[model samples]
Target: MTTETGFTNVDHEFFHRELDAFLPDRIYDAHAHMWKRDWASFTLGADIQNVGIAEYDRAIAEIHGDRPTETLFLSFATPDHLDLIDEANAWTADQIKGRPACRGHFFITPQQDPEWVRDEVKRLGLHGLKCYHTFADCSPTWEASIPDYLPEPFVAVANDEGWTITLHMVKSRAIADPDNLHWIQKYCRSYPDMQLILAHSARGFQPAHNLEGLGKLAGIDNLWFDTSANCEPIAHQAILRLIGPDRLMYGSDLPVSHARGRSLGASDSFIWLYEETPVWGEKHIRIEPVMVGLEHLRSVKWACWSERLTDQQVEDLFWNNAARLFRLDT
Candidate 1:
């Protein structure tokens, strides 16, 4: 792989040192996933599984090396975990051991019998709900993953129950079509009181060409996006400017692109958000690694975030906002 596009290899000295030295008492990483099973298949084309409990422990040791108070886990299972919603939540609950940072969004769909799994949802201490376009061979719109099913009262229940909803919102076929807007339109209209967090900054850093669809959804007040992998200039900057910081949250999509056997990569994209591109604008823009540090909260963004924002703002993003939104330990 070209050094320009391959995974970065930096001591990230400043970030590590700063995070280790200036530990926050209430910080919480909102977008990382936690699973204890072998997640090799999720690695896709990667050379290795890239994540596992051991590696996660090491990663937790490395980033949280300072050991922040808590972290809100975006619990998930492999594609294999989709169909068995009740089982998926049960597995993740065991993984969490019933803690906030160890928490997660239970997968939900209306297609099958649902199994609803209310008992498991309660037992698992589910923090929120997660829905993906790829699950059950489906799309976020009214389309069916099963070719005979649809997302319905299931979605309404999640909204009514006041569970945070995170949707994997950017892609090619599933996202770039008319069906893509259906859910947002339906959810925003149906559950006017719902809190919907869009995964990736309304679709990661879309160039000018792909901005319209994201922009349309921005009209919905219930719609929010996670900075998990939106560190790159395209969606990162645009979302900040267009969607505003209030609508954004930090996310690493951890281990997916990194080559771990359990967790996902720090991000699927944004490989160039900090390294090669000093600034992420048409020509010139402020390129603050600190902002990146604050956003990712684990890797190099720490040093940059410390330098860019006041100590309080850093704490706000790392802890306050997440605590208030997820109702986590403050």
Candidate 2:
């Protein structure tokens, strides 16, 4: 699968030898991002300037081998370029157009007019919205206050439109923070029309935090969890057990998930790179790393398989569940 960027599927022989037999025929990646470098604000280094649909296609081909797949492009939210939201959404929607298997979600902020959002959703036929809490509307302190987590105006627009929100939970313990969990519960209950897909299994950076949060919120009908760039198998297994197969979906968080640098062998290469930078006038620091793995999508499959999920359960995780959520069948 070659594209304009001279992007071709790379050799992922290691992934094949490990999990080929265990994987399904195809996958529906519920979470991914795609855009030209100039159109976006974030950077992963000069060598990795762009990650358009071509790059994504090549990478997924390498990861899945010969298996076919579908992906939903979630508009990336950057802290510095809040103004890029419309442009980012337009870029994604344009790139994935005419490809039924591919769809895109736009990014939104409460700062924007809700009526404009309603019109844009109808005009673009967008699948959903990718909400970056810390960047869009929240102050990223050690502990977030629930009363002011997300903008109520944007929440109302999404609910009125009956749109899905792909939320990356913020705060100290990711999703486990008491205030964060309470905010999620409030949103889910208050906005019955809105569907919420918690990214990274509610940011299971620590498996224990993930389990704790999942235990508290698993029964919510409108809530779903995506296994996107989550590296821990223990947390993934816990997600399956607590949230059940119907509420779990496949997500790669690609390009970000694409393994980079020299081979540190199979096992070692699976580990992603992390850079720690001082922040808050050196009072605190951010160690945000692009979650990478040679087999991120496969890792999710491996987790499901290890838990002895039936073929039907695997089907739901990789395809049907996302299909139902995003109305992909239509």
Q: Pick the candidate with the highest lDDT.
A: 2
Backbone Cα, N, C clashes tallied per candidate: 27, 0
lDDT (tens digit, per residue) of candidate 1 on 1-330: 212112222323534655556656655655666554353244322333444333444454434545544554565555555555556556666666735455577766544443454445666677567765555554553344322222555556666666677777544433344666666677767886567776655554433423445556656677766656443444444554555555556555654323311111232322344334434445566432332333444432433253354666556655666666776553
TM-score of each: 0.66, 0.82
Tens-digit lDDT track for model 2 on 32-125? 8886676564443345577767667766765566788889899875656666767888878887887787877787764667688778977887
Alpha-carbon error at 300 in model 2, in Å? 1.9
* lDDT computed for candidate 1: 0.51
- Least accurate 10 contiguous residues by lDDT in model 1: 260-269
Model 1 residue 257 CA deviation in Å: 6.4
Any runs in candidate 2 off by more than 4 Å, and if so which? 1-11, 41-49, 134-149, 261-291
Candidate 2 TM-score versus the reference = 0.82
TM-score of structure candidate 1: 0.66
Clashes of 1: 27
